[model samples]
Target: MARRTHKGEDDGTTSNNRLELIIEAAARMFDAKGYSATSTQDIANEVGLLKGSIYYYINSKEDLLFRIIEESHEGALRAIATVSHLDVGPLAKSYALVTTHVKVFHDDRVKHSVFFKEFRSLSDNRKEIIRGTGHAYSLFLRSILEEGQQVGQVDKALNPRMATAGIVGMLNSMSFWYQDGGSWGPENIGSQFAEQVVLGLVSEEYLLSSGGRKVLLETIRGELA
Candidate 1:
């Protein structure tokens, strides 16, 4: 694909750094204000760049939006990729996935908030690309649920696809009510949410050891850590 940068644009770290700065500022503004309502000038002002400088890197506002959404998904996918091959039971893998998902969700709330809410603003081609990323998430989580069922770790009666949707819905909803600097940090929230997910899946065997699941969780988490 052709480069978006202008022909005479400097191929230096400074240009790259400025592009990063613009994207970061744009994410914040787009989250605060709808993408349709934000302009390149507003982004430039937010980044302390001249209005023309935005054109130096991006061809249009949607270009910036596309970059932000893709970047957030890329960050999350990379993080979760580490958990895919963990030599642990499906239940523990599910727990780790939830925590990792939530952590990545909030690692930059501004950026990811735009990701979860504003993806529809992209062009159809770009929208398909974003949807592909989303489908990967569904496959990853659904596979874990399916594996757990097969191994008797999760309830065999549960529908893996529906279970995947329920868990993902609950985690995504956190973005709506979650506040920065809340009583709990990402790790704590992730653990609590992950525990709920694990507990919901185990009704008989896991409950016998008792609801604490603390010992089990600690062992799994320690290995993961």
Candidate 2:
């Protein structure tokens, strides 16, 4: 038999909804005020609950921060998983990764702001877990670059690790300055970033080749479509 929550529905569904509300509230507070400066009362107030009520969903403020960070990374991990399995070349895969990443940040700007700004507030053990996830995401990008190199699509002399770091850094920075109602929306920003990545990293010879140009054009069109 399913356990009933205070709200009278199944425990699982109600609990999940409450947890999401708490996390969303916490994310906004953490993004506006630094993690150390925000209190459980503030989070509870944000969600219209008693201070102690938050304890039902999370043990501590640090736990809330950890959950927010984890949620942000989980979005990226899911995007990577989806793109990794696609039957496309490195350029298309790379474009998809960029667009997906940008969309995630755009969709949850407050959560991602907390993710970037308050991650170091986590305990050592929790920090390690976040680091592991981040490193795996980085390796995914590196693998795509490596594949591009092998196929003569990317610049042979470019360092995959460095390239990955640079691209990731650029994408993550979007959380800082991207406006929700700005003229350039997530898709536009993503496509432009993808174009920059391809144009910057692809071989000069490939860029000049008629066949290579056609392939790149088709890849961008397919992603936009």
Candidate 3:
């Protein structure tokens, strides 16, 4: 039996599936055209539904934007959770973080693009909600760097907060230039980025030490595996 959504629509579409389609369509339109330039009618045209029908899935266009940003943030949190459980050192964990971060952007370019590009378009309340999630993700990265420093793998002198922000900024920038069929695939770009971020943060002594080499190789293998 087809379940009807709260909107009372009986198109034989599940509510979750319908909502996903609406959100995806909105993300695509918002990514290509600026949020301010994108209208409800535009989303409707992309989704092949009437403008009024969109309201059945969301309260307003702003709501759709908020959902997209929230979804991306949720994905980041999930990635952080996955990396946190790995039975590896901070360097390996950091490598996993970078790989996961870049892959998310590559996998969902439109959502992440809308997330990075149109975040400010959300209302104050929605902005606060998204900001909280962003801060949590930031703290997670900072914690990873701090753990690395404590273990003598990362530079003790480096500020974890600043390093975290820098790494995140570098990975997030991919949404601006990364194309679907780019010469460098997501794994290659992610692996190279992991090298840059992980090696840059580790101390010279650690890099030269046997333990450091083992850790580095293990981290690389974990990323490849």
Q: Supply the global lDDT for candidate 1.
A: 0.83
Estimate TM-scores for all models. Answer: 0.89, 0.90, 0.89
What is candidate 3's CA lDDT for residue 178?
89
| lDDT string, candidate 3, 103-209, tens digits | 87777788988988888788898899888988988998899889888889889989899998899899888878888887999989988998888888887777878
Q: Comparing candidate 1 with candidate 2, which one achieves the higher TM-score?
A: 2
Model number with the top lDDT:
2
Instruction: Report lDDT (CA) for all predictions.
Output: 0.83, 0.84, 0.83
Model 3 stretches with alpha carbons more than 4 Å out: 1-8, 11-13, 211-215, 218-224
lDDT per residue for candidate 1 within 107-208, as digits (tens), equals 877878898788889999999998898789889888888888877778888888998899989987876878899998898999999989988886466556
Model 2 local distance difference test score: 0.84
- lDDT (0-100) at residue 128 of candidate 2? 96
List runs of model 1 lying over 4 Å from the truth: 1-11, 206-214
User: Tens digit of lDDT per residue, candidate 2, span 29-59?
Assistant: 8888889999999888887777766777778
